[model samples]
Target: MNDAFGKRVRRLRLDRDWSQQELSLRSGISTPHISSIERGKRFPSLEYAKRIADALGVALVALCDDASELRSPKMRGSAEELPLYLQNFVLNEEATPYLEVAHQMSQLPKEDADLLSLVIGLLVKRRYETPVLTP
Candidate 1:
């Protein structure tokens, strides 16, 4: 079931210039365990997959195209070319006001700009916040 997923994990690890030992140390997963999983001789639990994915700087879905890959509502692609659905969501009305506010605050002092960006990021992530533009 996880054969392809194991291959993907290996590919991403090498892509990031990490050896199994490095990944193991960073992810707190043992090196032998990472090796077995990468070889498709073992399957990681959901939690371990998450820790590995985070350490690899990838979405867990990148590891598996299967149903067990949990979808995170807050996940945003770092890739330049996103799928059509993500493109549409980024263009939607809900994102417009926030984008406008972010653009307007871009010229502020670095500290002030960062603070405003954090607040805006929080509002965007919470999704239920009243979109009040605060300077």
Candidate 2:
């Protein structure tokens, strides 16, 4: 599969706390095959992709979606939209505490928003803790 497809599968599997072996068992695919797919060394047929998506409890299209599209310029750098974007990121990272802080930060005066730095620090920490799996 394409790199984006591989990344999406890896992300979904990680989100579900499944190791490659676990996913392979659930999908009826081999562990080595799943690893190859995640590494973008091999592409699954459409039927296999569907099975994998079903095993992950996600729609097939979700596995095909390009996450980078969400990071387009229009989605970045607007003060009014930043909190919403940050909340989504934190939620996807399973950092609910940081999501709550982001919500609270939106209500703070600009001068009192230094705590935003804390939110960033938390996200950075989480990123390092669970490095993105790149294909």
Candidate 3:
């Protein structure tokens, strides 16, 4: 985590033409602390991470390469090529159906599991329309 985060921060800072002292001053994180963090010797708390990210104009999670949010099943390349909704759907497909069905199914009783099932069935059908062939 430290190695990846430090490298990311260093890369971003250099990209912005900012030195460690300048970044520290802008982020309100002391120069010594910034040096420590950039050297992979220390980890910042959530608040500090946010401050640094804001200063660098990057997402807070960019400073952390941990698997839960940033690093898991990673995707690459520019976002301009694809739509944001499609990118998010492709990245989080595993959890989408479960969450959607759970929320919608909560109002129904045991017999209505089929309610969510029917919705999904229709979605699948609509997505792949096949023409009828008559002989």
What digit string (tens of lDDT, one per residue) describes model 3 on residues 28-132?
999998888888898888888888876665556666755523221112233345788866764686967865555445434446768667877998898679666
Q: Rate the local accuracy (lDDT) of all candidates.
A: 0.72, 0.71, 0.69
- In candidate 1, what are the lDDT values of residues 34-85, reduced to their tens digit? 9999999999999999888766655666577765443222222242377878
Angstrom error at residue 14, model 2: 0.9
Deviation of model 2 at 79, angstroms: 44
What's every prediction's RMSD, in angstroms?
14.6, 17.0, 12.9
Model 3: runs farther than 4 Å from truth?
Answer: 66-135
User: How high is the lDDT of residue 50 in model 1?
Assistant: 84
When 1 and 3 are scored with lDDT, the better candidate is: 1
**Local error of candidate 1 at residue 18 (angstroms):** 0.8
How do the residues 17-134 of candidate 2 rate in per-residue lDDT, one tens digit apiece? 6789888988999999999899899989999998987666555666776653211111122234557866567457677676556545644555677767777789989988996887
> Residue 100 in model 3: shift from native, Å?
29
Model 2 residue 127 distance off true place after TM-score fit, in angstroms: 51
